[model samples]
Target: MQSLSNRLQTQPDASTATALLQLQAQVDGDPSPAPSSDLDGMSLGGLKRKRCRGDFEVCALGGEVGRDVVERGLVTGEEAALYFGTFFQGCDKYVPVFDPSYDTFDSIRRRSSMLFDTIITIGCRAENGAVSSQYQALSNTTKSPIAEVLLGTTLPSIETIQALLINACYSEKGWMLTSMAVRMALDLELPDAYTQLCEIMLQGSDNVERERDLFRKARVWFGTFVLEHILSLDCGKRPGVRADGVAMRRCRVLLGSSARTTLDFRLLAQVEVCELLSSGDAGADVLLALAHDRLSPRVGVALSDRELGEIVQGTRIDLSIWLSDWITLVETAGATEEEKASLVVNLKIQRDWSEMTMLCKGLQGIGIDNVAIMSEEQRNLIRLAKISAQRHMSTIMSNTGLYLGGFRYGMDFVWAKCAFSVLLLLKLTRLLPESSNMPQLIADSKVLLAELSKVRGLNNIYFRILSLSVEKCERALKEDLAQAANPQNSGTQLNFPDAEMEFQSYVPKEFILEWSFPGLTFCWIPFDFQDLLMDFGSGL
Candidate 1:
C-alpha cells in the first residue's frame, strides 16, 4: 500500500489520478466507488482506463477522479453528494455527512449554493479570503485520507498536508494573497464539487477587470493543480514523484546569468504597447513570468535600473532574428487573427511588465532632468508591442484563411486600417533623433515600416508626423528630437479626422471635417495620406 505522504510528491494532473485511486481500492471495506446512471454504466469519460492497474484514483476534480470511486463501490447517491458538499456554503456540512450516489458538476455547484446561503446569513464573512485556508485544510485532508480510505494505510500528518497545499496556493507571481490566501488556494482538488454554493456566495462580481484577472489566475492555478492531482494518482509507495524536490525546484527555474547584464538600449529597438489587458495584477504577473521565463531565451524579472542597464549591454538587438522567434511563438496555435490578436496583445503586456520596471528607473536618472523623464526605453517597449502585433497579423490572417473564420476582405480587413496608424506612430517615435543615440530603434522601426507599408507605402493618414520629421535619415541622423519631460502624461493621440475644418491644416479637405468624432465612419471622401499620426500614444 502507498503511504499518503508519498502521493503528495509529484506534479499533479489528469494522468496521475488513476494511480492515486488504485491505492484507495485495496482497502478491505472500500465498497467500489462507481455510481450507476440511466444509461446502465455507459458514461462518456475524457480519459480511458488502461489495464485497471490501481485501486481507486478518484478526485472530485474531473478526469479519472469520478471513475475509480464508482468502480470501487465506496460512495452512493446521497453519501457522495453529502461527502463532497462541504466546499459549498451550506453544503460544507452536507457532503462530509452523506455520500453521493453520483458525481456531476451541476450537483457540486448546487452544494456550493447551499454553502453560499450560509455565508449570507453570517454577513458572508466566509467570502473574505479569496484563497481560503479553510479550503486548503480540506484539500490537505482529502489527498491523504484518500490514500487511507483506499489503500488502508496510515494517514499523513495534518501539518505536512497543510504545508503542501499552502505551497501549492503560493502562486508563482508574488501576489501577497490575503493571509492564508484562500481565493487562489480554492483551486486545490478534493473529492467533491462545490461551485454552485460558492457562486451564490459571490454575488455581483461581474466587473470586467475582475473577471479577466480572475480567469488568468484560474488558468495558471488550474494548470498547476491538475498536474498535481494527476501525479498523486500513482499506485506505489512514494508514488507521484521519487521525491517532492523535483516539483518544488521546477517552480523557481532560473533565467541565465546574462539576465543581470546592463543593456546599452541604444542598440535596442523600441515599441510602445498597451499594458496587459488582464483584470488584475495577479493573472498579469503570472502571464508575465511565463513570457519572461519560458518564451524568451534570456529571461528577466523585477530587475533594478542598474540591472536593466547591464541587460541592455549584454544583449544584442537583431530585429529580424528576434521577430522571427516572436512570430514563430505567436503562430503556434494556428489561431485566427482575432484570437491571435488577443494572445499577441497578452504577450506584449507580459513582455512590458518584465522589462519596463527597471527601464523606468534608469530614465528617471538622466543627468539634466529636474523632473522625472519618461524612459524612452519604456516607450520603445510599447512601440515594439504595436509593431510586433502588426507584423504577425498577416501571418495570422494567412493561417486561419478567409473561408473558415469569417475572413472577408472588407469589414474584417477594415481593422487593418486602425493598426496601420498604430504602427506609424511607433515608427515616428523611433525616428525622433534625441541626444541619446538610439539609431538601432530608428533602424528597427524602418524595418517594421517596410512590412506595414506593403500597400505601396501609401498609408499617410496623419499630419503631425510629416510636420515633425524634416527628412528621413539612416546613419549620422541630423533631425533634432525633443524628449518629453513627462511623456506618460502626454497625449500621443487626438481625435483627428480628415474632414474636420477646425483642423483644416491637417487634412486635404476642410468642409468634410464638420461632423462629430464618432460620425467619421460615413465620411466617404478620400484624400492623399502622408506622415499619418506618427506614433501611437506611449510604450508600456
Candidate 2:
C-alpha cells in the first residue's frame, strides 16, 4: 500500500513536469507532446490554462519584463526604497496622490510597474552622480513598458493612469501622455468612482479596505482632471475633462472626513484654482469666440475695438475676483506654513500665466505694423501682458532658491510658463520700445532664464530654446542702446521714412526666428508672428 501511494504521488509530479515542458515548448515555438488527460486534471480549478508566451517573448526581445514584478531585475530593492523615499519627500507633495505613510515601495511596485518606474524616474532627478546614472538606466528600462501601456496592449488600471499623469508633468511626451491618461481615466470610469464612494459612505459601510481603495481611485481621477486643465492651459488647448460639480462636492465631503491629510488640501486647492481659471466671465467668452474665429476664419460679425476693450476690462475684473477668492482660501486652508508657502508661490505663477495668456489672446492678429493704429483697448491689453510677464518673472525669481535648488519642486509646465514670461517680455519690448522700464525688465528676464538653463534638473529643451532667444534679445537690446547713445555711427539716421517700414524692419526676421522653437508650444504667441518664430537653431 505504501508503494502504491508513492507511485500515485510520482504520477502527479510526472504529469506536472510534462505540463511545464509543454508550456516551455509553446514559448520556444517548438513541437510538444500530444495532449494528455493528466494535464487537464492538473489545471488550476479545472480551468484551461491561458498562454502568455507572446508576452514573455516580447519582454525577452526588449530585454525587460512587462509586468509589475519586472522591476525586480532592473531595480534593486535598496534602489527602489531610496527612490520611493526621494519621490515621496520631494515630488509627491505637488501631485499629492500617493500616501507615503500608507504606501510602501514593495506595495507600489507590486501594484503597477508603470507607476513604480515613473516614480523612480522622477526621483532620479537628485544631484548625486549615482542617482543620475540610475535615472538614465531606469528611464531606458521603463520606456518599453511605458510604450506598451500607452499603446493599449496592457490593461488600464488606476495605477497606470496615475503613472501617466506623473510622467506628463516631467516628460517631453506630456501632451500625448496626458491625452492617453484622460482617455484611460474615462475608460476606467474614474469620475463615477467618487460618486460610488460617496454612496458607500452614506450606507455606513465599515469595509475600511474597500473604502480606501475607492478613495485612492477618486484621488487619481481628481489628479488627472486637474493636470489636464493645467496642461491644456500650457499648450493653449481646451481641457479634456470638464469639471463635474457633483464629483467635486463628493471629493470635498471626503476631504472633511478623518482620512483627510495636508496633501488632500493641496489637491483640492489645485482643483478649485483650475476650475476658476476655466470658468471665465463675459469678456472671456468674447475672447474665446475671437480665438475660434481666428482658427476657422468664419464670416461672423466682428466686435468693435471699443467693445473688445470693454471685454478686456471685464476679463481683468474677473481675474481680480478669482485672485481674491484664491487668497482667502490660501489663508484659511489649515495647511502647514511650509506647504502653504509653496502652494502660494506655485499658484501665483500659474495665476500670472493665465492672465498673460488671456491678454495675449486679445492681441491676436494685431501685428507690429498696426501698433500705432491700435485702439486704447489693444494698448491696454499689451500693457497688461507686460505687467503680467514682469510679475511672473518676479515671482519666479523671488522663489529661485526654493524652486531651482534642492529637488526643484515644481512641474515642467511651471518652468515652461516662466520661460514664456521671459519671451513675452521680449515680445512686449519689441512692441513698445519707448517704455522706460522695459529694457531693465527684459535684461532681468534674460538673467533669470540663464540661471534656469544652468540648473541641472530644470534645464529642458524649452528652457534651452528660451535661453538662446533671450541671449539674442540681449544682443539686440544692447545694439539698440548703443545706437541710442551714439547715433552718428555712419548707419542710417534715427528717423524713419514711415511707421510701417520702421516697424517691419525694427527686428530682423533672423532675430525673431532665433526666439522661436519649432514644434514647441510653450504659450500663446500671435498667429502673425508664427513664421518669424520658426526654428532658427536647428543645427544647435
Residue-wise lDDT of candidate 2 within 1-540, one digit each (tens)? 112112111112244334555645655777775354323322221123332343332222234444532345666667667766877776787577765545677787777666788887777654232236666776776566567664334446778787888878766647677777777766666666666777778888888778877777777877887776555545546555555232343344675545556677667656554444334332221123223233222256455667656766766676566556555666677788776677677556656765666666656534322455566777766777778777877887788766554335456555555555676666665666555475677667666765664555334555665665666666666666776788786265433323323323333232233222111121223443443345443532
Write the residue-wise lDDT of candidate 1 on 437-471 in tens digits: 34544454454344334422232332223222212
Q: Return the TM-score for each candidate structure.
A: 0.25, 0.71
lDDT of 2: 0.57
Task: Provide the lowest-lDDT 10-residue window in model 2.
Answer: 1-10
**Residue clash pairs of candidate 2:** none
Any idea what lDDT model 1 has?
Answer: 0.27
- Give all candidates' CA lDDT scores: 0.27, 0.57
Q: Per-prediction count of colliding residue pairs?
A: 100, 0
Q: C-alpha displacement of 77 in model 1, angstroms?
A: 25
Tell how far residue 446 is off in model 1, in angstroms.
26
Model 1: residues with Cα > 4 Å off, grouped in runs: 1-108, 114-308, 313-326, 362-540
